[model samples]
Target: MSRIGKKPVELPSGVEATVSGQTIEVKGPKGTRSFKATDDVTFSVENNAITVTPRGKSKRARQQWGMSRSMVENLVTGVTTGFKKELEINGVGYRATMQGDKVLKLALGYSHDVNFEVPEGVTVTAPKQTEIIVEGIDQQLVGQVAANIREWRAPEPYKGKGIKYKGEYIFRKEGKKK
Candidate 1:
């Protein structure tokens, strides 16, 4: 038996969930999200809670059992509380600014500024010159966008200069002795 699959996902007050076919829809103050599970698992909702159970004792069924439950949990969390990712720019003259609505202008010591296009369902904001905040109802999208932004200027260990996640630790190495 899967530990995570056994626990039912509780629906908070003001939150709603409906199951139809293989699709499960969750609606909350933030937004509404839906997910469709495979036939390997079964989904049921009762007592303001959602549960996932495998149809048979097969490898695939067992795999889908836990995954389907987690996906449903994510949907609830996304619609209710949403998700956020913060980034900190570290290097000299490095900064970020929001251009117009969906464009993010970044200066990372390069000769030209990098323009990052914000995708739909995700909001990118630059609260400060060195800070960037990415928010979205979908947890995967939020994390992916933040990762793409970091990929542009990943922190270098030499001087610990570049863009990094908030509270991320960068290992420092001693420079070569002259």
Candidate 2:
């Protein structure tokens, strides 16, 4: 009865999927990814699509069946098209630039500039010195890299100066009176 679980995942062209024991491997033009299925879940590939089913009628088995299937679908899509996160720097003098391999230099009104290294499989791009783009095949890694970069200069409540996701809302707080 899982809405998402009932939908079969379509396999894209040039992507290969193989199931061995409890492991599922998906390979595509971008890269290869693998995931381990839970004991109570079952999976099969047919007609260029992947389907998942729960092995029992228990609630826990049903819950894990949908979750595991969604995760596997995400992995397949990620390896093929990849994922991306965009961030913007607000406030005067706050900027970012690529320093070197796996390194990003940020200037955010701090005494010392912040340096962050891009993790493997993730790419960071600063197109306008104030706008950043993070891309990768793994959704978790992309989000984590964006969070780490944002932590260097979190948006302030009063001035809203710092790194933030594009289109994200920031609530401004009133400043103290002089």
The lDDT leader among the candidates is 1
Indicate which candidate wins on TM-score: 1
| Tens digit of per-residue lDDT, candidate 1, span 1-178 | 9999999999999899998989999999999899989999888889999989999999999999999999999999999889999999998899999998799999999999999999999999999999999999999999999999999999998999999999999999889998
Candidates' lDDT values, in order? 0.94, 0.91
Expressed as tens digits, the lDDT of each residue in 39-140 for candidate 2 is: 888889999999998988999889988898899988888989999999999999999999876899999898998889888899999999999999999998
Clash pairs for candidate 1: none
**Whole-model lDDT, model 2:** 0.91
Candidate 2's error at 57, in angstroms? 1.0
If scored against the real structure, what TM-score would every candidate get?
Answer: 0.97, 0.96
